[model samples]
Target: MTPALDIAHSVSGQPWHWRGGVIDGLSGSFQPDDLVTGLLLSRGCARDEIDAYRTPTIRSFMPDPSIFRDMDQAAERIVAAIRAQEKVTIFGDYDVDGATSAALLIRLLRGLGLDAGYYIPDRLMEGYGPSGEALVKLAEQGSSLIVTVDCGAQAFEALQQAKDAGVDVIVVDHHKCAAELPVAHSLVNPNRLDEEDGAAHGHLAAVGVAFLLGAAIVRRLRDTGYFDSRAEPKLIELLDIVALGTVADVAALHGLNRAFVAQGLKVMAAQRNIGINALLEASRLDRAPIASDLGFRLGPRINAGGRVGKSDLGVRLLTTEDPEEAKAIAAELEHFNEERRAIEAAVTEQALELGKGQDNRSVALVSGKGWHPGVIGIVASRLKEKLHRPAIVIALDADGIGKGSGRSVAGADLGSAVLAAKDTGLLMAGGGHPMAAGLTVAEDKIDALAEFLDARMADDVTRARGERALQLDAVVAPGGVTPALVEALEEGGPYGMGWPAPRIATGPVRVIKADIVGTDHVRAIVAGEDGRSLKTIAFRAADTPVGQAMLSAGTTRKLWVAGRAKIDDWGPRPAAELHLEDAAWAD
Candidate 1:
């Protein structure tokens, strides 16, 4: 029932437990820790259906779009716009998910010989989500039908204004919604109050929902023989955009989402999209991109556009056709990403200092005047990671108004708490998913808002913090760590926010070499009793207990290294290396 060596406590003082894995009934064809079986058990794969999950496909996981309440209405309206040649616009949020969702619709409409424009509100200027003023303005500009992607879920007033202005709107979003729906012609959201079968997919990102809508539109158009004269646009080709948006939004990678990313990576590797190709080059990615690359590399650059530069730049890049224009946009986004780092660093430093003085509160609420509104979300994320609890960072403007973004730990539903605060008239406006949220508040109400959130969510935060655990997938020996094993682990991917990459413990190894790398990284080569050795690297942990122990321990001492397996291509031949997260000395 217990591990051979107790690595229950990490250097940060969290207990680690092996995930719910069974060594028996594994078909007796492989070891308990074999890549395939480990992945299957970690994800709770059924014995008979293991093969199906091994290679997820849209055909296997795609649900009927009409299962959603307003899917048919939304699809039919879109088709009508295509037939009437009416001007349509896609209204989107400012993050990666919104940008990609807008781009998906624009591109889909374009392929059908329809000219579609897009509107992405400025992060600092417009705050978040669709506004009634912006919607009415678009209607005045001749857009008969407007589709809001990744937003409009909580735009009760904005949607009502748009409806009153005589403009038809379709909402394709996946944010959490209240019981009373927004006033729109059709709202295609899984989180809708009356949702039935579609509610099972409540975890989808806005782009994923948009992609479902795209499927419905294509199907309806096909039934009407709209594609007989013109070639049917291959919706599969757009999965690359879907993959990027889904991963960047931190959507759970289960069921259909895993299929999307798994197949989308293939589409991305084809280098078909000029914009994506340009972005890859800008990121210095010479090889094919993977799922993690979406979150760590491409997502950041796309987000940088909304964070520190022009908000529309991301959508423009994703929907562009000109190679030169793509390159220009990609380079601009790259520059913004660099700028974002500097701004985020400054804001994070200030927020951490403020957080240190608020240890008495369940949630860390830090605010500063003149902070960049664009970087508040990133700063909040950093604070949550460092503090291991709910965090809210606010950027106060000169006119006594503050725009705040918040992130929460797993068991804490900060989104619901924020919504509750907004309902109590404590916040001017606020909405978000369970783990993340955004709000606008009067400067003077900052303390009141903090107290309201803490009081409302105190018990939940405490329970969540108490249940946090480090889950390991399997165990391996030093000799078992090889490039072959690393490649085999791919069957369990594309790992992300909800669907984590597997972590393994390779133990009873003596440290042959350990040293500090560039900046604050710890690098070491550990060997087992069989004399098999492998390299490991702990990033940004040179001063931490784990890194210090690795560097200072004598060669005679043995330890278990815990981390994810990575393919190391630094040598002529590929090797497996561990991105070390934690290590414990062997008893």
Candidate 2:
């Protein structure tokens, strides 16, 4: 069943003027399933075009890594570092992209029996970059080379410092690029300013880039006879970590990122890695790892380490081979998740309270003192949904540093904005992708940054908020949402991030029965004029927008319900049920 918030179908019933196939030679009225997963794909382009996305696979879809701007250089540099047997250090971000990239790197290096270790930046003290202090420390510890995963794209100053200190940096990052490239020794990013591929395959997260690097290293080693007649590590084995990190980082589930998940999920489901097995047990998820498991179950636990606990907890959890140690780390992360949630709630509540009466703006900036710095980004994202604006939330610490995170609406270039702000000397440091970004500012600059964002984003915000039409795929009848339909939908999944679940709109159902179920759940049976009926449930929506609307449904009123339908087995007879997404009173 779909969630209560799922809006299945959006049919602005303008009569179908063209009766025959709109195309010159087609004969059908465009069934999205024939080409796309759900009605959603049909909205963007022709059905035939979307068909390729339905069943994602490794062989059918993998793009050559060399297509990325700096992949070749990145590959050669990584292999050369490995051959030298240098004390290599992988500097990573604290999030899933960072951890998974670190894990993938660790797996690859260990497979070749090299001395490679990774360090993740501390979320609180070091922030999100290759800290100069840490880089100097690594050099002192005999680290001759450092490869940054998931970060360092914007670390021009830090990379300069590392270079001056006699440490080589092979940066493996996928963040948004700036006008001027950083000075890392071997910077490898698809988003490099000079990338000429029309593929524009910069959508991959850091972990995806690392996977490619792993593949490149293996290829190079094999070519050079380094693995001559010797057992070589299957680079594909690291896909599990790659997939988990890519999905967790919320990278677009397209192109190479899709390949990573397709291969990685298989490895994860099979429990190939001992540490991953321990994580699975700790998360208490279904044996098979689905995209949902990564999003809801695993990603959060991994992130908990960076949010309220040690930044290395995630790396520790991912790299440990011992079941006992992995299990212990998993438990600690689980506890940290609880703490993170509490802190997130507290920060969000305060932000919302402070922004109660703001007016007519394209951006919302909220600030709080002493709120946990780690959760501001999530809170900013939450506000973006409610207010439909580019939102930035900041929490100031006693040291007078404002830790801020921002989530942008469609069409806003958040990372660029942060870069611009930094260029103008208003920020201490900040850079990220368009949709998500972070910045560190002096405590006094929050209001100034807000004003700067408001001016820069006014036109874009107004254009987007004025566009509020719901997107629908195709309309379905109660009978159409059968077990067969559910199975068909699964073919396109596991969906998350950029690729969303499909929503089908059903007829204006007459309220046959409706009642509030579980603590805050709403359940009912909605029927059509032909007597066909389907059960529906809306979880955790008792007094919310959809909840209030459902409770008001009566026999006389015909309402359109849009959402994903799932087979519910809780009843004696397993039956189809609509997970109420959104509802509108019929005209």
Candidate 3:
């Protein structure tokens, strides 16, 4: 709804891109509050221009997974292994992917009444993946088939150890594959070298692949009589877990992942699982589930266990059938998550200081002594988003062994960069997708690793930055705020990494109310000339770039706002609110 001008307003000099897109297809106009959000729906199916925004689905395949090579084979092998009712152990990572993968596999196994046990390496002790110690032990415990969920692509030595101990290992992973994959009974990884599938799907976190494995396994079980004695465990039931792992682990939310998330949210809203329900209740989420709720609320709590507490925290919480046991583990994770936030704040400050001076080269490599290895990945991602550059955050131990995680910008090749560092013998072990990866470097070699990465990634960084542009959607006067607009976005969502929630642009408004909310958040209201306005809150902005921008802005300058519309029920009266982003003053 375009507002008629009652009085003369600020003259627009340089016009911005309307950042517009088709809305519900029938109405080709870009509504002001529906800019970035409309683009997300239009980018996908035409039919979804309306409903998908409210309920996004992976079932609709916008993301072409043909880019990944081994997805099909990896999916197929998992089916074959699961149908036989052979003893299985899911070896997963300590973080989100590993936790989700283990959860997915263990759930499937338990549903089928098969021997299923999950093993997550202790972050403080055993390191990552299936270690020699765990592998040998699994062999001794009479495990016939060992299915490594997230971490097996890097376990070359341990797989051989398992094989020698008379154990057949099946690796269902999504990581940078080595020249020689572990000599497992069968390695099912989208990142495997010899595969013929597409690379686009390789963006899936291990949990996503494990979901595919779950799908294939259920199919194979049907071909046999696995369900003859009992109804087969519904693969759809696992989608909730799949979606949780996929979104929480920050995988691309395109293609099947879209379906996973879209469907998963529905399942999650039903709160079928005792563990998921406990997690939701412990997190204090009032309304039903949304994709962001999983990322902001649930994912972090699950990861808290591995980051600062015991690695088994997530595994136990997800797998325990007992309500009291699940509640206990979930509660512990909630406490750990609180502690993790404090640790992250301190670690991020130290990293920012260390990264202050570096210039020109694309990657930001920050090393800190005695940092927690479990939380390195999130810190790397934070640094990358802050500087708009690739970043590798390393945690160095007293023993001079540095464990690190990396987050990459859109254009930079992070997987290759990690590989190059490893090639030069600076890293002990490391690999990942372009957007995110993990590795371990010797403490003394941190400088050499950073320098090595700069050389390899400098050109790509420059190329990526040179293509600067902003696609702003519809322009709206401050008078157009309404509850109806927020409701419309629901039909277009189920958003994730590849697909983002829409952001509306508005301007010619003055700051009405602005205050800091959480540990690092700013809450403010921007009012237009017509006495109409929107509420906005920015998270993690306290003492940061965005926080300072909102807190210190004077009322004299008219500022434009871009953010999502949310319904805040905090106070007795419920009303709509705005989440602030970038702003520019009207000249």
Candidate 4:
């Protein structure tokens, strides 16, 4: 049945919408009395699946590794290398996903009595994927077997070159693949067009795919009696790395991916990996990291290595066993992160200025002659968020060739649009997922590319913007929001990306006090009809209607505050605070 969309006019003048899911099999078998279970039911979880979701064990959600196409082949090749003691090399992307994928395999192989080397393509000098020259060079350096992670899915020419050079290469990637496959020893990707059971897990990041490959390798070795004399490495311990990579890559946290993060957090909290521990210390996070910490803190430091510093730093940091070396690498990454932030800020300012002038265009296209290529992606993301449309930020080099990165708004397939541009000869090279993409283009063709995107993607962009709606989970009184409630809601979590944190609306509250806090945040305290007052903060919303309305609201005005409930431990007692997202007046 088509459910009616409940819509409300928020104080920000944007339409707030909620579409409640019918509790499947709710024949009065079990009734949820708490916020957590109610949140689960609202998000489409069946009563039977609640227990599994609450715990989210990999054993419960993990699919058999053999379900993927070429899984057997990929596993067999790795096992052969381990048996023969052949030198193996890992080629990984510079991003966190690639770094962790390489680190995971290197750690696994090292445990099995093989030392594997790794290579990361420089974002500036080498660009995105493996190059034919790099592959041939690695083969020349005595790497008998090479595995490419988070990349090589689009390396048709490079893979062919590797094959011609007599190097056996296995591709473990999650990027969108073309109809024509790359020539590799075995290409293992759930996103492959012809994949069956694996195709359902297309949302997996490359690191998730690597973990699956790890499982396959272990299973194959176990069957061959390779572990008869040796103690099997505990594969579960590596979930910490898996969790970091998966969350950093912004993979949707649902199904298997959620299980990975949920279990991975438990593994991470143990501080088993020296490098991870060092990173925690460097980031000033004394406690165990949450899902948001992976994305904001540690993830950015690792990404800083790829963006502005040495591309190999991330893999080195992740693989290092020496605590001192790990600490040094973490510190270096911290420095790089600072540099990246400065660079990103400058580029974002320029990109925003250029993007603001592009109000008439459906997609913002901003390019500069000397903007650093490393920071363009971040700038694109900022522009996309501000413009509420797809945004492309291009960095033009001396030869008039430009490297561009783009971010897409929800419901827009910017990556597909970029791919179409490549196919139309407007781009030199381009590919990505729906939300993000990268491309190379001639400086002179920027205008043509912009025109092409505007004309071709106009309808999609418009439809996407019009369909935007905020989904709220439940409504609760101010007194109902408590530390216990927040703790309970977390059971269904490790929430991120597609699996969002539950947002609740608390209504019939009068503003007790409101003021601007920090540079651009609105902070307020409101008293509900129950005379319970709660603190609320709306980040980066000072100038927006939501913030302005809250900040200037009269004491007599009663409003409903909608946002995620979070645990704030600033005081002696841990209390639940509302991270205000939106609000509406109530009678």
All models, RMSD in angstroms: 2.8, 4.8, 4.3, 3.8
Over 1-587, each residue of candidate 1 has an lDDT whose tens digit, in order, gives 22354566766677777776632211213343365766776777777766667888889899999999999999999999999999999999999999999999999999988989999999988879999999999999999999999999899999999989999999998887888888999999998878999999988999999999999999999999998999999999999999999999999898899889988999999987889999999998877888989998999999999988999999999999999999999999999999999898888889988998877788999999989998998899978877889999999999989999999988888888998888999999988888899999999999999999889889998898888877777677777767666666766788887778878778778999999987578999999877889899988678678798889777887887788888885778778899988787775
Per-residue alpha-carbon lDDT of model 2 for 1-587, expressed as tens digits?
22122323333222112111222101213343552434335333246645455555666666677776667777787787777777999899998888888888987898887858889888988788888889989998999889899899888888888989998888888877777887877777877777777137678788877877777778878889988766899877778888888788777777667667877898888788877787788877644777767876899889889989999988888888888899899989989988888888778778877766666667888877888888887789778865667888988989888888899876777887888888888899888887889889998887788888778778877877666445444466665667666655556666666666655667667888889875568998888766788888877567566667778878888877767767674667656788875677664
- Best-fitting candidate, scored by lDDT: 1
Q: What is the TM-score (0 to 1) of candidate 1?
A: 0.94
Task: Report how far off residue 164 is in candidate 4 (Å).
Answer: 2.2
- Which residue runs of candidate 4 sit more than 4 Å off their true CA positions? 1-7, 19-33, 510-512, 529-531, 554-556, 569-573
lDDT of each: 0.87, 0.75, 0.73, 0.86
Ten-residue segment with the worst summed lDDT in candidate 4? 22-31
lDDT measured at residue 451 in model 1 versus the true structure, 0 to 100: 94
- Residue pairs with colliding backbones in model 1 are none
lDDT of 4 at 472: 74
C-alpha displacement of 355 in model 2, angstroms? 3.1
Which model, 2 or 4, shows the larger lDDT? 4
Q: Report the C-alpha displacement of residue 157, candidate 1, in angstroms.
A: 2.2
Off by over 4 Å in 1: 1-3, 22-34, 510-519, 529-532, 554-557, 569-573
Where does candidate 3 have its weakest 10-residue lDDT segment?
A: 5-14
Per-model TM-score, in order, reads 0.94, 0.88, 0.89, 0.92
Best of the candidates, TM-score: 1
